[model samples]
Target: MNKNIKHILIILALFASAYNASAKDYLITDFGAKADAKTDNTAAIQKAIDECSAKGGGKVVVPGGEFASRMISLKSNINLHLEAGAKISAIANGAKYTSLVMGNEVQNVSVTGSGTLFGNGGKFTIGEEAPNRPYIIFFKNCKNVLVEDVHLLQSASWTLRLFGSEHVIVRGVSIYSHANLNNDGIDIDGKDIIITGCHIDSGDDAICLKSEDSTKRVTENITITNCIAASNCNLIKMGTGSIGGFKNISISNCSLRRATESPFHKWADKPDHYIGIPISGISGIALEIVDGGVLDQVSITNITMTGVQTPIFMRLGSRKNPTGSFKNVIISNITATSHSRMSSMIAGVPGFNIENVTLRDILINSQGGGTREDAERKVPENEKDYPENRIFGWTIPASGLYVRHASNINIDNFQVRLAAPDARPALYLDDVKQLKATNVKVDGEYIIDKAVYKANAVNTSVNQ
Candidate 1:
């Protein structure tokens, strides 16, 4: 009955009232969706979403059942919640999945659950004899979105794709897609996005942040953290698209493991088709501001890799559209153990170059053998139709780091040892400027290979 105690109690009561007013729930099973022991309850689930959206945005609950459906489009202010043991399996037929889930400028939408969304991709067909078509779970132009605690398994193509979205959070999601071809886990083409606490084992790049398509805007302010990625083409990749550039991105606290057996040949017609494509291993952490865009302020830190082919690989060039230059990139605290060659390169057009790049605290353990002959092979003449070939060469020299046509580069605390003494140099620099290397130890010696290092004509420093 004290005055101060009464005042505190009154404040607590007000806060509880506010919280109750804002919270809402919508259950799917209540809306004529029977979780019968045997039934394809796809239509019933869709009905629940329609009713929930009509009722002005609440949770669409999918209880424990095998709900088979094609696509379920999400609405504004709606949260699709899947209860434990609940599974929404995609129909195998492409016609069944013909309806795409459209999210055009919808705000405050979320799909969160501790359940599974299975893309029965094995049933779809792609090429003439291709077993199944590539089906994707795609989101486009949605803002303030959150997708978490879901498992996407056996997706045909890219498992999860976000395009032109903002303020999106994808966390605690596990995607398993080894059976399907080109099963990239998450393809992000959005801004202000955070992807964390996920595990992706895919056929292609586990996580790819693409900025192709010159017409679309650049993707910026993206962060990927606390993830485990394995059995993919590249653990984390960027810029293999035809449009859109990326900036202000950070990838940290992740472990990437390359599968020893080749996964690329699964989708290839002939065994020799993708032989030298650099398909296996953590090929590289690429930052290519190429094809017609500017890439700036990107960093990759605290990454550990094992059984990878190439520890570090980078390319910068202006081949297609003249908008070039990769600026302000830092890669630190990377450790790799592998048998293949370790290589990194930065090359670009005449005017634009890779600039202000730093590599620190990198350790690599490679087999004494040279670069794999297959890895050194050039792009096949048949695949010249691709734009990537026109932009950059097929074969990259086998070395610890190769720099060409770059400026303001720093290398510090780098230690690399080859399986044998016949291995290539630890560092190779050509036609670069303002380059400095400190505390770089290789094979128990400091490498000063003048053949690769060059001082620019104007400045006294190397390629200044």
Candidate 2:
């Protein structure tokens, strides 16, 4: 056995021990659920779950075999346990299966085992003839939920999504996707969540958080740590659909890399298209507050990345919604090797400026071959358009970092090293107020004239 599988088994053992000691376990095969990979066992599994629920919150155990099902609904106080070697492959018809497994308004629910879930993502397409596929696992308005020690593979859409849930803990879950479009690894639209000790490789954003409810219920108190992620899109992202806002979030001890083994890599190349739609290179972290969301008191630290297009990308705009506030962000101890097509940027709308942002102990090694014309390019006030890095033209005005329409920014022990010669400055500051940079280095030395550029910046100081 390999080390990673062993670690997953250890976590599975702990989870199984906790739930097995309390629930009255009922094996699915014993309830007449066929193990044939071609048979639809949805009714059998539903009967088994019903029986277990009637017996006062027990476990519906799926033994080692291949079971095919369309959609499985989980009830409160029930534990759906899949043993080692067990596989649940989705078999849906018409457009798409509603979902693989779902939990709605439930409590004390768990899904844990050293098993696998196959979503058959490649079978779906994005053309007009294809229907919008469903997610692998979804939880809505659920409480006291847990999902651990599972191999989630080839999801049709967003793999695992938690919406309006609270007090959720997900650990030791591995996700490998890259079959279809918009295959985000995990989407957390909940509060009081913890996602740790996981590995994710996908075609889109790996770990993303959002708040899209109409009740004005914000997504808050989210912590994601000790995970490794690779994606063709953003590794970590929040808010392109921010109706409720996000607050009190922290991400640490994570590594983000590019997915070189994606079957759809050609579709993600620069100026490439995804089966007809255009695509962009991946960003290590992408943060945006475009649709009337409040983003504040967020901290990201201890992130190491490689083969990324942009190390960090942030934007705050008003698009079809009221203007929102974006402030109080701190990013520290981030080291990255990034592509130089575009610089890491932090920008806000014309009248709405990002405020109170800080960066500490940051280093980026970029493949910079930017020309003077690229530096002199006009930056448009793309306030109402979609908020993303590549959408701000092919290349930004700066080679290293760009800060526009922001205030009260500070950078400490920041360094940028270029791989190729370029005429553009390393850092560009525009329409910034009360900016301070200390111990900032370019290449191996600190040269302000050759590195930093300022326009319409007030009260800015680089430490001498």
Candidate 3:
């Protein structure tokens, strides 16, 4: 070989050796750590992470034990693996646990294994009573991430939150929260994410896709499939915190159950506050393109839900500064049953209306009656305080589904059954243009109520 080629071969050999060394897995118990299940194991885990990072990247194995700690930080090229039977529990006291795990632009990182990460946060107190704190695991500005096979329990806030991340996968994880005040299971505020095969139960939204504020940093390409969400405020909700809008999202093959909160005791010191919000449903699937952004190309299909209030809700508004519009949305193949009253609304500002929205093959069974005379009594009450609130959309009575100030809307194969007799119509559309309802049935009757179509009527019909 030539002299230059020989030198290049030597350099290549050195680089290959370094890569092999960096990819080697490092054991945690080797660094003077005990998996005895009683000792404070935070230091040992941190030491293991430091050593693994220094070695250029590797797996830090947590052996079988109840390793108690908080805020476990992950570095690049590192995989924190908990072996089967390994239980890493967080300290119960708030002071003992760090609130969050700060990410440092790390890539190729994972927290995986059959073990469990139990946040013993049920013992902590928030507000007057105990409130769930933030996430048990938080990753910010990360890439190439994997969090699988972990059981997260009893979080005060969201169990796992991914913020500003890319190429992320969350699978086969179970998250549970019974306290229900602020317990959301997995909250995604990033881009290019897939969450599949997870079981989530919380007091609030089971899976919330959100953006903190409106900065035009859109969250896109999110796919959620084969997940079970139950006993949540909403099974899956998008944008109560949508400052920046969302795009290119799909959700399928999910089962949702509206978890019934245990009745509150009047004599108890702290009573649960049930605020009446539109999105506070058992299987409430909402897409609100509010906060000055555009929501486009969103689709939801093949959802089976029981014990839900409102199964579908979509609202678009420029609350203070209306920046964009909501267009090209579709919802199909949804089956829902509810004991609570169902309410859904789609509305926009005067100039900008929700456009190109479709609802198809929906079957709902509601126990609560629809749009009673007493429900319309709120109009006069709102006029007493703020009369302008009565002008926008308040004169329109509440219904199972309310569509106001929208255009190009279609509702096909929509059916609803009430448990009791004398139930009203299930479909309510008002102030909408270019609306079509084919094969729409309410209690096996092909009827279109004139009061629902009296607001802004244009080419509205129900085909038998």
Candidate 4:
């Protein structure tokens, strides 16, 4: 085993031991909760949780039945445990929204069970706008949290969001929440977190990490492994909200693909010819630093992506703040198959160049049909535009990868294949400095132009 994996397993094992100390169990049925699917069990379940917390920390058990509720809040040192065949469905109170489960300023809390949480998400929306909809689970400013072995489906919005928290673990969770817009699988903003062995299919970004403007806490020391993520948007993304920044993040052994459901929002393009078909995800893995944050020390490896718009995209934009930095990123052992006009990209602003990036052992097969006019197109520097795969107008000049305004980039054993013949370069570099390429095989041409300096190329082949 790798040393990093071994150390991470040891740390996870030690963390798991802390949950076994609480042994008391409090059943919700004893607190006037009904098993009927129509009864409002919000107060009953809350009372049971309150009693359990009042008598110190314990497990508030929900047995095998369907309970309908409005909001369920979890307190400190409490575990919300559900048995097999247990189900909690959120009631549809139109125009009024409350999270189905929320924990605020709590510690040593967990929600674990082989059960299901269903939000009647379709009833809360009106004409593509969900004015008021409930979140499935939202935790804020919490510590030592664990959410495991639960089935989350049809969430109103953002299935599980953790903000300004630490020491979190989410494992064996299956989320299918395509019933509404902005229904992200998991939005995490914390430190020392691990997300493993989960399957997510969502309408928006799956397994996203962000540091919003509401807190000063940076999202750091996070690990995501052995997960399958499918979405209409990005599969794994860090940013779109980069207030405090991200650091020391690692992702490995993951699969990315298109969403299973058609989208509810117009952001996902479903053309007239492909009306009912599921569109590929926008970007397989995207990293953006747009809101004045430092993004450093990110490592991604052993990833497989299928049917994505762009396999990888890294951007440092000046949307909200122009003082952000993006550096020290390493990606390796990646295989991807994409079908889009837009290409993988590494972009930075004019004055702030992305620094010290490495890509090794990458193989990509794209459906390329670019024309010569596309290759001769002048790309613009959209410094303040919204950071997205197609933000700079679609049909990128390069068919394989496009790099601009970056420095100290190293590429080794990088290969590209095309399904259709393209009259464009396979790799295009603009204003890039200190670029080193080794054993790169391109299907078309490789061009370095416009302010590129000191680039070293060895064993680079075209149409090989």
Candidate 5:
């Protein structure tokens, strides 16, 4: 053999050996960590993590049992693997670490395995006037992160959140946080993130995406797929927190439903609060770019939803300035059932029309109790207000779909049904331009009251 080739082969072998040597596993129990829930294992667990990080990083194994602990910090190149039937129960006090598990500026970190992280949320105060409670898992300024196969329960705030992180994968996790205030399942405020094959039941938004930062941050290259979201609030929501822009997002194969839980049975507080909703008074899928952020190039498909006030909501609002815009959105293959009072709203503020939106292969079944009085009522722009479906205050003019201040909008293969009596039009368009609706049907056989109602619309066509 050539001597040069032999030298290269020997160098590769040494590198592999060193890599394997650095990736050692450290058991937390070996470092004076107790498995009994009665004992405080915070110091012992932190010691184990510090020692493991000192050893060039590796797995910090928490074996099966109940470990009562405060916040645990994770370091670089560490995998915190919880064994089956293992639980890490949070100590019911102070906001020291701000979360049960936290990572900051770390690389190659992961938390995996069939275990549970319970936050004991009853110990928390439960109103918006209170301070923001900590999440179950909160990480920031990290990279190459993974969270898989874990169950998170009863967070005082959001269940999981990532801010300013990259290359994150969260899969096969179950999050249930409906017992308290701001109980969102997951909030991602970063780039290159994938959340797939997860189940989330929450009182707030499930799978929320935010780009809220003082300085500009771009939330790009994100994908969410094959997830089940049960929520009392919006099932899938992006941006009422858009200080930065969002780009290149795709969401597919998702299920959205009202959470099957009750406040009396689940929470048992003094004043009854609903933990979950049998029918959500919120939208199923909501997107907004209100706080001076550009939102563009989003695609959502294959969505199934039920028991929502509105099936979809899209808004390019003006609550803050620079006055951001939204464009180039595509929605396809959506099936939804809703107790719609205000219709599925899609509108941009004046002078900032949401541009180039396409909806294809959409089917909606809605409870239609809208009267002619409600239909004739003019909808408010509410540009400076917080962006929400109910923020408009009253019912919209349409029973099925309502759109305003848009351009180049296409609605194809769309159908709607009124489950109850509705005097409103099936679809309403106002201040729209270059709109087209093909193969659109409403009320089974009718198209407008039967067709569409248009006002100040230009260059529009509808073929039933």
Candidate 6:
């Protein structure tokens, strides 16, 4: 061999040896961490993580035991691997860490294994007036992060939030957080994220995407698929916290249903108020650009929903700014059963219309009891108010789908039915233009403005 090649080969061997040494596992128990569930192991766990990171990068292993901690901060190039049967219980009170586990401005970090992280949520106060509680796992400004195959339980606040992070993947995780109010399951507020094969049951929104004003991060290029979400609030939602907006997002092959437990139902003092029977969820899917931001290029398909108040809700309202843009959204292959009288809505403010939206291959089986007086009642333009399906009223003018202040809308292969009779129109469109429909079948009337209706280009059938 040439002398230069031999020297290079020797250098590569040394590098590999160093890497293997640095990547060894450092057990938390070896660092004076007791796992009897009584001792606070915050310092011991942090010590292990700090030493592992200082030596380069490695796995900080939490062995099979019940360990109590306040909060633990993770470092770059470190993996917090929880062994199976290991349970980390958060301390009941803490003023130090706002989150049970946090990583800020870190890269190549991961929390992977089949262990459990339990937040002592029952110890915290319930209701919106209660003090702010700590989040379960929060990573801010992180890159190349992975969280997989872990069970997160009983979070006081949001569970598994990634804010202003990129190149993140959260897969095959299980989350159950019904302890208190605002216990969202997974919140993604970043770009280039993939969240797949997760099961989430929460007291609030199950899978939510947000770009809050404080972050100013455009949540773009995100994909979510093959997830089961059960929530008292929205199963899948975007915004109500938008400032930099959302773009190029896709969600498919997801299941949405009501939460199993409604412990703090409507912030009541009673726990398990809706026992034996879970209440219907607020919405299966909701998209709202209430704050000043643009929501564009979103596609959702192959979704199934049950036990939800509303199947779909899209709103463009003025919360902080006067107006925001919601356009180029396509939702298809949806089958839903809504139990409430409120209709699925696609609405915008009076002056600003949601544009270029399409709904195809959709079917809704609604529990309809809309009276004639309900159909004739005028819907309010609550443009500046908070966006929700019941914001307009309990019974919208339309029994199946209600659309207003939208333009260039298309509905194809759509059908709506009721378990009982409904006096309201099955589909209602107001202040809409460039409307197109094909193979549309409704059990009741189709109340559409002539200005927005296309004669031959659209086909519709109604049964009264």
Per-model lDDT = 0.65, 0.82, 0.66, 0.83, 0.82, 0.83
**lDDT by residue (tens digit), candidate 5, 1-464:** 95324533453353334334546678888988888788889998899999988887777888999998888999987778899988998887664458889999987788888999988776777764457477899889998788999999998788899999987888899998866778889999998788889999888888899997778797888889899998877899998789897899999999998876644222213222211224463788998898988889999999999867788999888887768888999999999988647678888988889899999999998776667777777888888898777667547778777889999999999888877777778778999999999988777433224557899999999898
lDDT per residue, candidate 6, 88-178, as tens digits?
9989864546788999998878888999999888777776556758889999998778898999999878888999998787889999999
TM-score ranking, high to low: 2, 5, 4, 6, 3, 1
TM-score of each: 0.81, 0.91, 0.83, 0.91, 0.91, 0.90
RMSD, each candidate, Å?
7.0, 4.8, 8.0, 3.8, 6.1, 6.8
Off by over 4 Å in 4: 1-24, 126-129, 265-278, 443-464
lDDT by residue for model 4 (1-464), tens = 97446645664564455445556688999988898998999999999999888887778899999999988999987889889999999999653656888899998888999998887777677334556788898888888888999999988888999988887889999999888888899999988888999999998899999999565468998999999999988999999899889999999999999888755644335442121224778899999999888999999999999968889999999998655999999999999987777888999988789999999999988777766777778888888888888887677877777888888888888887877777767677777877777766665333333211122332222222
The clash number for model 2 is: 0
| lDDT value, candidate 3, whole model | 0.66
Compared with the true structure, the alpha-carbon lDDT of candidate 2 equals 0.82
Give me the overall lDDT of model 4: 0.83
Clash count, one per candidate: 19, 0, 5, 0, 4, 0
Candidate 1's error at 295, in angstroms? Answer: 0.5
Candidate 3 wrong stretches, greater than 4 Å? 1-24, 36-38, 96-102, 128-132, 260-281, 318-323, 371-400, 444-453
**Segments in model 2 whose C-alpha atoms lie over 4 Å from true places:** 1-23, 127-130, 265-281, 444-449
> After best superposition, candidate 6 residue 407: deviation in angstroms?
0.1
CA lDDT, candidate 6, residue 429: 76
Worst 10 residues of 5 by lDDT: 267-276
Name the candidate that leads on TM-score: 2
* RMSD versus native structure for model 1: 7.0
Better lDDT candidate (4, 5): 4
Between which residue pairs do clashes occur in model 5? Answer: 447-450, 447-451, 448-451, 448-452
The TM-score measured for candidate 2 stands at 0.91
Query: Model 6: clashing residue pairs?
Result: none
Backbone clashes, candidate 1: 19
